[model samples]
Target: MLGSVTTVEGIHYKTKEPVTIHIEHGRIKDIQPIAPDKNNDSLPWIAPGLVDLQINGYYGSDFNTIPIAKGSVENTTRGLWKEGVTSYYPTVITNGDEEIEQALQSIAAACDGDPVSQAGVKGIHLEGPFISPEDGPRGAHDKSYAKAPSWPLFQKWQEAARGRIKIITLSPEWPGTIDFVERCVDQGVTVSIGHTSASAEQIDEAVKAGARMSTHLGNGAHLMLPRHPNYIWEQLSQDGLSACIIADGFHLPESVLKVILRTKGEKTLLVSDAVYLSGMAPGTYDNHIGGRVVLTPEGRLHLAENPGLLAGSAQLLPWGISHLVKNGLAALEEAWDMASVRPSAFMNLPSQNGLTIGAPADLVLFELIEQRMTIVQTYKQGNRVFDLTTSTKE
Candidate 1:
């Protein structure tokens, strides 16, 4: 019955009111403000589930690798639930043409085989094969596969992915970048500038050609640059482009994070950009991107061979949010918005604000205890996908 409901009482994120959210048939039916129920004091704050735009992999599963192990994607989806993420994009980076096609097909197959995986996966983020091939700007992506942007190549990828590729990051300095960006825009795909040494004019032209965002704005670049006229400053000053930051505290310093947050304000998005070792224990491990990466106890992942450069992030989105709050880079609410609201809104997704009637009941219940944010429960479309209390009992 429409009237039959499961009432979820908590402090609402937007109104900051104590309300009982009624759920029926995987949607929020109603939200009625209620007096504080002292008997249910253990309830946590309710907010929109987190959305990550770029997650390469987690727990030893790299999305760019073809022939993924059995249940790898499903396991990764469940791992994300532990941190209150309801929706995310599996990022596919630079690889051989055959490997890239196989990876996309594997992701599509996982979505087809599992309802939960399909629900959590928003789409795919293609992060490479069209970026700068220079050593520093190329970062960890294989140089062999890096090349100029091509429309036909993207069309083939789209066909293999079953049209699930929603975002692509590329360098605007390439020869055919403008035409490719325009075509992607026409097809309702998001274009982000990254891993490039594009001049200010190139950046402006890319924006004019329909680039809407900067992928992990402060990363995938040379270690040093001129104080002015650099790609970073150009993207920051561009009013037409939004920026995504990796707030994991390793990719960017706190001072840089604060500056970007201030400059971009509402346009800033927080992404995990996590790799295969994200959820693994701290240790040295061999990886496909780099020869060897060491996960330090301080939660930093560095190339064991070089030791000067980072491999990728070892933390998820929640840790980034918590790090921002703890380091005073941003307030709790502001950081949460970057992870949950801003990314979805930038992607033109529905229900950017949480707990509205008739919207899917995708919600997260969390609390800040002793300055550490903890996930109490996570729900997707009104189904209890994760519960810390229940999991411990089992």
Candidate 2:
């Protein structure tokens, strides 16, 4: 029940038809549509594995914490497969120069040492020493370490990461941001705007300089803004930029998510932006970054002092996908794509082909019962990784 197989049978995620997907040599070899049997209604839905662009860490592993533990990256990678995530970027946030370098080196070393990490960690997301230092925009990042983007400094981190840093999130508020964005894009790193108070004109300039994404577009900004000239408006207007959002229900309201989805269309992507507390039990937990945080039974992670404030995203892609479907912001197929296929396409990964022959055979089997998505199994590179039928893990 938990071993690798040549083929997987499930209901097609898109067409809702019974299908037999054949896998070989870690790639999809064939996809056969089959006539529905009486038991077809009980089959799980088959979909492409999720690709998360900005996950910080999982369970007890933290990328932001200085001196990442020896096997943390490997542990995080294996933990994610259970959540149906086959590819992901491990996000390292603002910190002291040496701390960031050390963090990168540890992750790079883990990837080099562990086959699972090497395969699952698509890249590292360097989320800042280059973001806005303003109170509201800075979020939980250390303001003392915030500074202008520097290509040479990034190169040092990239070297430490073994050139695994693929996405860099920075604010375009600094004077030379356009040049920095250009440089990052030149090195094949995705330049994303985030944690900013930049003007619309500045955002336009960054986009022109090849900034192609917005990290959690509507968050990490001043709570109040000018009606039409704000950074959010500017990002939404830039057709060249794909917007990643945190759809944990608490991070954004339905109206805003709906608007962004309609505006960006296929450009809309979902990111958990999850913290180490994710996948933990429902209880109050001490967080070094935010003092005290609470993870609710319903999966909402918020500040313990004030329930109104969000601590961080404590859920995975399935929660976000289910939230979208439940809220009527999108149907199940489109919502699933936002968390899986869409991110892969944005990053130009092979999984973008999604349930088609010739793509990487990273796949998931799940069932949606009244908007709760239960991952039944997950396969990475055509090999079964997680099977709920035999797992006793949380």
Error of 1 at 320 (Å): 1.1
State each model's C-alpha RMSD to the native: 2.4, 1.3
Question: By TM-score, how accurate is candidate 2?
Answer: 0.98
lDDT of 2 by residue, 1-394 (tens): 2456799999999998999999999899999987857988889999999999988889989998777776789888988988999999999999999999999999999999988788998899999989999988899899999999888899999999999999999999998899888888898999999999898889999999999999998898888888877888989999999999999898899999999999999999999999998888999998989899889998898899999888889999999999999999998999999999999998889899999889998999999999989999999998899998778664
Window of ten residues with lowest summed lDDT in model 2: 1-10
lDDT of 1 at 241: 92
Clashing pairs in 1: none
Q: Which number leads on TM-score? A: 2
TM, every model: 0.95, 0.98
Over 128-219, each residue of candidate 1 has an lDDT whose tens digit, in order, gives: 98999998889888899999988888899999999999999999989978989999999999999999999899999999999999999889
Query: Model 1, poorest ten-residue lDDT window?
Result: 1-10
